[model samples]
Target: MFKAKNVIRIGKGANAVLARPLSGIPLAIWAFSLTFALALGSTAAQQTPPPNPHSPPPTSVTHQMYLDMKLGTLNIHGDNAVVEALVLQRDIPITYDYVATLMRTPNAFGEGPACIVCHSSNDQLKSYRGLNLSSCEGILLGATEAPANPIVIKGEPFQSHLIQRIRNNRMPLGTPFFAPVDTDSILAVKDWINAGALNDENFTTKVLPLFVDPVAFGSETACTECHKSFRDPPSFNEVNLTSYDAIMTGAFSKTRKKQNLPGLPIVVPSNAEASPLYQRLTTSRMPPGTDPGSPADHPNTLLLMRWIEQGASCD
Candidate 1:
């Protein structure tokens, strides 16, 4: 398991300044007699570099100083001007490996893909309360502050919406999402949530591997082999799902024209329902052949549906 270290804070002070290696030397040389003479001369001349000649004179000394500082004064303020720097170090948890292992095994629920059983369009479209497993990041992040309602993030395993849904008898009730998630997985998710659900490099690298199929299925192979021509745009109306990037970007469309739908967008992050490819697969209307059967008749189609529902990802 990966562990993160505490944040390091460096406070600003004279010591901090002195610790920094000095750069170029100042042009002016100060001596006791020279400084005394210069001070006396300045007082007699009533001249103090014309209070920064480049800057506009202030209406008053205090106001002038304030405006000059605001306008980019070279002078630094007192101790209050000190800056504090903080560095955070994070580690990716090994729970992602466990998730990958679980995904590879047959779902106990006798579903297509164990991962998809809990994640795809079918789950999200349900009328009752349930966690949308489409995007792990989305579920972890929860909703942003909006006008109508604010989504909350659960810092602990028991408090998380995903955890609560899994525990509930209503959801994944008969599904794998309801399946027993290991304590390590729960803790990993909890740690991620507590850490602000950041999509940092480490988190992404770990999470992505869990979402991709360990073994390539027939549909992925068949689609890649048989559908070479449709891979590019203008030939198949500019909708290409030949690659993961294309799928996430919503490059596939049967109508050859783009249309807007409610819920999640196909190309937008966490917008699986709005994705046309998912819609076609879940609806059992894909392969674009002359005769397409119901979704129930196609196992490959089912797999694709499950993959999408589980969070369509390249990893």
Candidate 2:
């Protein structure tokens, strides 16, 4: 009736005893006992239950998962130390859905909704400020026509512009609206920055254009035709295309009224195949006044496809 622990201890002791030979009779008896004990110990250990190696360690609990809703892929990873803190301190799984919820209803400082919600040139929050959180390339790589500089995301908080603003408390100011941000949100951002602001397990564009050059697409004009006058408010389609902010927010026709299709938005960047704008340009369905042209005959169609393939980012 030996318990699991006792069985193991007895097995070890039998081995030690059997290592040295005593009187013939004692040694023979000891050998038999040792064999039986070893077998029992092994059986008990096997039935005791195997450790869950895949389970994150108790102290480590930084969990992250990326969902490219359009791509239909789920990328997941975890750091037990960080995950534990996220669970115990933040009480949330670091998943795309979770992050999206945070972004939609961000804290005072506007931290959440993932990077695309803020860095994108077509973000809904463009009207509030000229900030685009869709892609880091335009803002961080200076790929946009405006020529923004690279945004470093490493080292001390002072080194990074994003961190500096957060640390200096210059962000989440109450000019247009005022709301308090949570300490945990700020810490999470700091932790992300400290970790080199990695895009691993996150949806990212494979290639980013140097600039949103309409000329490259054989268009002599910018997106001013239908997007101008956004600098003021209530721009065409309730969108502003004057700056990165406006463009991101205005690019897509959210309401069904403005949408080309009966029940679909004009632009669904995530689903290029389903977007009416892309279908119109890439296919033979030109607008009312434009000359009827085939999708293959239109160079702009290729450009639009390339843009969509590049995540349709305004950055």
Which residue pairs collide, candidate 1?
A: 119-309, 120-309, 212-315, 239-251, 239-252, 264-271, 265-271, 266-275
Best by TM-score: 2
Candidate 2's TM-score: 0.21
Candidate 1 structure quality by residue, lDDT tens digits, 1-315: 111242111223321111111011111211222232222233332323335557655675345434433344423322112111100011112233333333334421123344334443223355122333344443444433321111123234322333222222211112222233333433343344345444666446543232232222212222223322333443332443344444333433433333653222234334333233322222221111212212221222223323333443335
* Candidate 2 CA-lDDT value: 0.31
Q: Give the whole-model CA lDDT for all candidates, comma-separated.
A: 0.30, 0.31
TM-score of each: 0.19, 0.21
